[model samples]
Target: MTKNTTINYREKIEHSHVYDVAKITPLEFQPNLSARINNRVLLKREDMQPVFSFKLRGAYNKMASLPTDTLKRGVIAASAGNHAQGVAMSAQKLGCRAVIVMPTTTPLIKINAVKARGAEVILFGDSYSDAYVKALELEKSEQLTFVHPYDDPDVIAGQGTIALEILNAHPEPIEAIFCCVGGGGLLAGIAAYVKAVRPEIKIIGVEAKDAEAMTESLKQGKRVMLDQVGLFADGAAVKQVGEHTFALSQQYVDEMIVVDNDAICAAIKDVFEDTRSILEPAGALATAGLKEYAKRNNLSGKTLVGIASGANMNFDRLRFIAERAEVGEKREAVLAVTIPEKPGAFKTFCRLLGDRNITEFNYRYSDPKEAHIFVGVAIADPNESANLVADLIAQGLPALDLTDNEVAKLHLRHLVGGHAPQAENEVVFRFEFPEKPGALMKFLDTMGHDWNISLFHYRNHGADFGRVLVGMQVPPNEQTEFAEFLQNLGYPHWDETHNPAYKLFLG
Candidate 1:
């Protein structure tokens, strides 16, 4: 965090050899995004890199600067994502033997990509941390040089070249430069160069709200490890930021913004609309943060820049992203409305919509006296959802907004069923765990016949994690024991027993 460290990093970036293997990505102005937000928006196209990510800059620079004798001995690194590809390609370019340790759960496409670059791929363990431990052991046993993904000085300096490029591309007055934070390599590198050179320009970092290690670290005045991270933005999901990156970010980053998965999906769509290019969740992170920051501050007429970090998107995820983008963009509202079950009530409900397009509607006959419906309505303004809910209430129809409810958006809309009258003492809970073979079986085995499962729902979104909503029937006397069971289950969970959406449709 010292000024001396900042100067050292800036100097290293100024003379980095990243350009030996990494290309100079363009900083193109986004006209569509600019006009829509009423501010000039520029995108740093790192997604166009040879490895389809900015990771190559750091990985190559670190390897290219190594001593020839050391390179002959080979190198090793552990990563399950973009970093692995960066190292593989860099090693191929440098003609050095490279060994990459990746999780066993990594996709075959990624494994093949690394092997195609002539690097040796070793799949071990079930997560990055486990693979990292294996890599360390191999490094010592095989006497190979280890490449620390984001923690090393050389790597940080190489990543800093991005900031230098951004400044040279746009010399005009700028409002802020947004960078997405994972292990803090990208953001820390950008912040170091910007703060050292363009002190007047703001340097902001963006992170998923569920995986905000840097944000939490800066707030706590130290690096804090998270118990778990949401895997939707897996590219930027880090339990802890790197030591060097954390120190630099602590002193250089001006501000940090946290956004959710919905916002990320919307940002992906935003970029697609502007440039006809699709970005992965982490790649669109800074764009999402930029939109939120601009709206929150109400600033306009100034230039803003966002890093489109990568585009290694999974094809299977497009459907889920498309479904959530509308909600994220405030273009759609999901609601639960109750009305009299008498004849013509359904017609009255449609009449109340009054030309407002219904994106989706689901109803099930639950009670003789009342009816509950799940609905999705299109809206141009974000405030229109609250207004519509109020109007529905005024008309004597009770309405609850499920636009912000994770449970409702993820599962409830697909499950509109009559209440389970015979299911007694049922408690609904949502859970997330790393997706892998036998994961669900492990969950079931952990339950161990302690409670009967009344209802269950799960759908894959092509993410590293799996989400499940379960209703369990636990006797009142065993509530304390059930609490202990959940505590020891080792999965992130939320109690949704009293959730309004659950009560209306399936309680």
Candidate 2:
């Protein structure tokens, strides 16, 4: 945290035989992704480690560096999941007792895994910040050594070992290496070692769109605490980057990239298709960044590497990932269209489709002459939706692309109903707000608690932004005032009261 001093981490990385607890994972080239991107898309298979993550390298290195007396006193650390497993397994190997304090929100599978590694597990509070407090208390009470996840010099050096293996396995010059940043330990270590040895290659950090602690810190030249961070990628959901890691990242990293949850889900599917492996959301973050980076830079025939950081995925979460992956990849399209409500009208519209596949269709009669329908169609390519929209318009069928519309995707897509007949002076809207803890309270405070909410729907996708559909009862006389209020609200909102899809369903 103090002015960072120059460290010879490249020298340490050269000597680190992470093979003590970690393995020299394969650096495999993804043929399918490479062909698609027109680049040599290489995957650093850190997910193949015995612990299913890269955490063990740092954890073992730090613990192994501890003096004999400190090992006898044991060590304590706070972690939600992956780091806890790393510390526990490392302690076991060194014949040292490890105490892990974890948030109650951690998945049971991860908690059990840490316990299986012979660590005493303590489930404390709701988040990492809370559990961290408890770990500090225990460290003081038991006179134990505290393993700082990403802040310690030895820990960062251990993680730097990854860069050594990467360059060794990949002889070809790389355009860049993409890494995901949570507390920034992995990015910090990799950037340090890589920058020292290969100053020409770019060391880019990837962060979740909402959980961009390091990105903001680097922007402002100081650490910033996020009010809340998305939990979909639980392993990388740190509210703030470690001070040491931030300083290191600022010194060595070339640039940072932010990706959304949908892109991450799509990347998970991409890795599965390429290597028959399912990656956790955080694990696939680097892959998502690589794809976005390659497209943005328009670089072809160049080599790029993405670290598959971990595979600690829960089985039940697959359903949600699968459902959103299509939207993330733009392989599926959603639309709201107006069609005549008469016999043979639906048939006539179908004929204009020209063999495109339909994924979902929801329709209800809204008027005597015309009907509004919400439709989902599969596209052969990511950019095909715009062309299809043009095709539908050319056929005299009024259509609107709802694929990127937040309200349509989250609420209206799943809802189907007639008009709210008894509701008076109702104005319906869809809003996207930050997904942190107090986001809804701030929105309601901004809107004034005096208004009545007639309709509300929210589904959590573990992403940075929370999508909500709300119907507020407002008098016609206050229309102009409401518009002004909306303009100042600062959240991305759409007036859905006049939307044909809303008229057909839950108007």
Candidate 3:
């Protein structure tokens, strides 16, 4: 409950019982990333754990430390990710009953994995917080020991063993160690050990920008609860950092870095190139942070290490990750160019590109005077995108960069046909709906047939939510009524009515 000086994290970590169920994962050298970043890089391969996550270390240690009577009664946990498997596998290894409460919205693959490990699975609520509440109720009612995902002292100590392993395996100098923070358990544990044993080694925590609970918490000198967290890296999407973990992080963490989803995808690719292992978004967070940190500081020839936390990637999400990897690495530039609709226009554009590889080209003749084309070009340097745009403008082709535009990348790139000139008063909106049955029907039923549907685009990227881009014909007089409709919908929505991509393509 409090950061007591009496709690010896080093002693607890040194004597952790994790080896009974968790493996001592390899600290492997990354040749590709090392060569590319000009730094000696090593990856702590926690992804190679028995349950394919470092979570087993903490889970097993916590369970093994429990009293005999408590273990006999059983253990309960709430998680929709690696923690659930960690607890389940630990329970199986200990020959104790385990019950895991998971969100109903959790993927079937994960649910089945826990069940396969011989743990009773209870699908409850819509999110991890909701499931956690249910788990507490069940824990009290059934007299089950609650195995917290990260907040417990035993759990933090268990995770700290990773720091011991890294320091023992590589006795050489380590400039910094990067690890991802969700509820701050992983970073908290690692930082606590590193700071105590090797204070000179920097312990940096990485988080997704949209789900930066630890970053904000450390900034305000307290734990801050977020209203919502982006689920791209669902493993590290906790809205609030755990109390014990936050306390440890406050004392030991050196720096906090936030990265976007694109960088995470690129980090996945980086790991795959060196190790041929695919890491989930959260698993790749530390690598992404390491790359950013190295580039930002312009540090070369330093020994850097990152923890590859887990590899429980959903097969369906690969398509989306692969597509964003190029942009994240600054290897692809997306642009919208306006060229005269005449013969040899394409040739002239190609000439201007000057041997640069074209990744994608989407075009449809809309106007006799001009043509708007969506283009993706390969670039070796990040600065090349600006230079290429300048070249286009100098050659009389007006070019707009859409590489950073969410609307352009998610919707406009696919809807690059001729505009609907006849759809009067058309307004575009992007909506996120829960990826469940009848979600679309619910949206349509609430819409109430007041406006005409002019355009619609929906794509499933194997995420928890379904993203849809919609265009509707609403009269100016009813703008207030349309606004009220969106508010009542209860779904996250963004207005793209004036987005340049829509204006140039579908508007």
Candidate 4:
């Protein structure tokens, strides 16, 4: 309805049956993070709730206040993940039936969670909006009551209870509150309650840059539907903010901050280091906002509370998280080095590395005439990276650092050794064995130091074969040394170091 109308509804939510909801979630102070940020940090551990998110607070509060006869008709909601679990768990707790329509792409863990909560989970759609469309169809067909995720007045009010708990727990003056904004329901509710009680306390909404629906909407003074959203932060990957939530956000929200994926990844790592809790990208939004704000304003000695929203991360996504965390924190760098392909050339390059541990090293001979090799190294610090480049230059080696380059990280890292000079005498061998129990030692024993590996590329591909693309530095004098070595190895072999394509890529 109207902006003021939602505030009125929020007041009604205070008088509704919300006592049970508040009893379940209470604000807890995080002294460690507070000390680091030079402010008092309190976490509302909504992730520890029954549904592993704060969504249950609004869902339960809304469903509990509905008329008994309406509840008997059953409820329907569309969500691919957290919201589905929240609605299912809340309905089960209230002795009501919930039919959840989720996207087919939703993880099995989430789908099974909804079904385990006694909700009928219908997998239909490729995204949340698609599921929402299907949910509306089901509501019409089954005569079920629809529970809007964030737009409804009751849901907003239920989320407002979070503000009440925070104030009650920390009676001391709070300077600012950082909360993640998805459809803007959480921000809308908390902003209304906190601003009403202590008008001076600033309410800041944090959103992922990839899914900045509310921030873009507020800037345009109307809802703007995003064409596509990044699904990494699934909890907040909403295309548009709810009408009611958007209105309240416009009225009470003081500032909106958008953070990139890398910042969120860094924040996730920060939370884990401080609290030992694994937060999904969306869950780390508020903390990311706080860090960004602090860095921007040079703020210190202000009481800041960041809501650690939820922890429902997909297990399979952890690898991506780990890979991105270093870049996010500016702790890792990727470099490409060109070195003279000669005897002891690699040894000289290795000496120049100078205490910087190599996270990754790859090299291949591209051209026999040029005799240059391409190598990738991962460094520890961004500041040290520049120093490393200078060191390589002084040592007469040329290097191109691509640590900040996105394309290099995604594609170039994997497509490294394809191009090199095809040596008719070069031997290409595929070692078949698990990456365990001295497999490399066995392969090395077969050669007995007779052959020097000119080009070596080994990546553990989670397969039976540990493919080693080896090019022995066979002098014109020792061409037969490699042939004998390959015959004794007893593995599939092919010579590709002399391939024309190999020359282009590796050179």
lDDT of 3 by residue, 442-492 (tens): 788888767999999998888777789999999999998888888777777
TM-score of each: 0.97, 0.86, 0.96, 0.77
| Ten contiguous residues minimizing lDDT sum, candidate 3 | 1-10
User: Could you say which candidate leads in lDDT?
Assistant: 3
- State model 3's lDDT: 0.92
Q: Please identify model 3 stretches exceeding 4 Å from their true place.
A: 1-6, 476-484
What are the per-residue Cα lDDT tens digits for candidate 1 across 1-507? 354364578889999988878999999899988998899999999999998999999999899889999999999999988899999999999999999999887877788988999999999987888999999999999989999888888888888899999999998888999999999999888998898898999999999989999999999999999988888898998899998888898888899999999999999999999999999999999999999999999988889999999998888789899999999999999999999999998898889888999999998887889989999999988899999999999999999999999989999988896589899999999999667888778778777766889989999877767789999999999988788778777788889999988888898
- List candidate 2 stretches off by more than 4 Å: 366-369, 418-421, 424-505
RMSD (CA, Å), each prediction: 1.4, 4.7, 1.7, 12.1
In the predicted model 1, the residue pairs found to clash are: none
- State each candidate's clash count: 0, 0, 0, 12
**Candidate 4 residues 397-455, lDDT tens each?**
87766766543453346657555354434443434432345667767897786565656
